[model samples]
Target: MAHIMITGGSSGIGLQIARLLVQRGERVSLLARDPAKLEAAKHALQSQYPDSRPVHIQAVDVTDGAALHAAVMDCVASQGAIDTLIASAGMIVPGSFLDQTAGDFNSQIDTNLIGVANAIRAVYPSMIAAGRGTITIISSGAALLGIPGYTAYCASKYGLRGLATALRLEAKPKGVSVCICFPPDTDTPQFRQEIAQRGPETKRFLGPPKPWPVETVAKHIVKGMDAGKGEIFFGFDMMMLDKLGPIIRPILEKAYERRNKKHIGAQEGR
Candidate 1:
């Protein structure tokens, strides 16, 4: 059985992954921001994995490098060595570029980019020492295709994709594998909130109305981690986009801008 530490394990895809891992008899520890959410997640998962050890929860904001480092160490200490690390915590604040505050941009960078780097730095030593471990970074399809009003979110996830690619090269020699995923429109509370905040006027610009269940995404992630795959682009359309992203990115960006013209103009006029 492998010990896994998942950041953002309080809910959404992270929580789903934790529950699935526990059911498979793997030891799971969660690093999250809310004590109450962590405790509730622990209770909910523990009831499902009755034979497993009490689910470990460390309340640490991923943006805090010191706290994140300490939390990773604490989880590693309890679990012996981390067999897998999933950088699954991320946030999205949807709006036109003009509507985006400096804080909004910074928060996405801090959480989605720097946060992943921090977690890797914290656990990499032990993973390298062991000469065997896997990392699954929960990236998004937005990282591949630029979307209207999701500039900050896309930039942060694109940064994660770059980081994961670099880490894969560095960790290969150490026998550690990295699996980065491009999960498309997962039906989590986060996605719901993003849709609601985008409002009816701007929603059409998002294009396509399918948001997949978190459980399906979580299952693909676990399987990819097990296989040590380099990348997993969840869903058929996302796979196609992954293949064409490099060539079509520019055209796609122009199309997205055209779709959001009214919203962008409105935001700029505010």
Candidate 2:
């Protein structure tokens, strides 16, 4: 069985991914900031797959590099060498760029981008020595465009895309495959939180929140990873965005601007 370690594995997409892997009889190690959540996730997985290898849980904030590294090491010690590392830990703050503070940008960068780097750095040596491993990065649709309220979120996810591109070049020669998944809005706690903070312009441009189920996304991601795909784009919208993002950007921007104008006018009238 493959030993897999996932950051942010206590909840949402991460937890769902763990559930799938455990069902497949793969050993899973979950790293997250909340100890209670971690334990709860472990229990849920164990209850589902009682005969599978014990689920490992480590409580550590992804933003804390040292703590993350130590937790990763402990996970490795308990689970043996990590055959796959899924960097799913991420955060987002939705608002106009002017309304968002420097701290908002920094926090997203530190967790979404830098946190992935730290987790990779911690487990890279082991994977390198083994001369084979898979690294799955969970990016978002925001990485494709500069959404008004998701300015900081866009920056962080865009940074992840660049990181994945460069890291793949280095990892391939070492027999490591890096897979990046660009999932559309997923129905998760994080998405709910993002919606609560979205600006009027963002809300208008985005329209209704039609999110894919976390299980569906996890299933696609795991399948793509197993296929050794370089990039995994879910849904027609995401596939189109991946291929035609640059070509259609101007049109999208204009459309969003028009929506923003109407939204701003409505707010003023109210």
Pairs in steric clash, model 2: none
Candidate 2 runs further than 4 Å off:
264-270
Residues 90-153 of candidate 1: C-alpha lDDT, one tens digit per residue? 9999877788898998899899889988888888888898898888899988888666677788
Which ten residues in a row are the worst by lDDT in model 2?
197-206
Q: Candidate 2: lDDT of 48?
A: 82
lDDT of all the models against the reference?
0.85, 0.91
Backbone N/Cα/C clashes per model = 0, 0
All candidates: TM-score: 0.91, 0.96
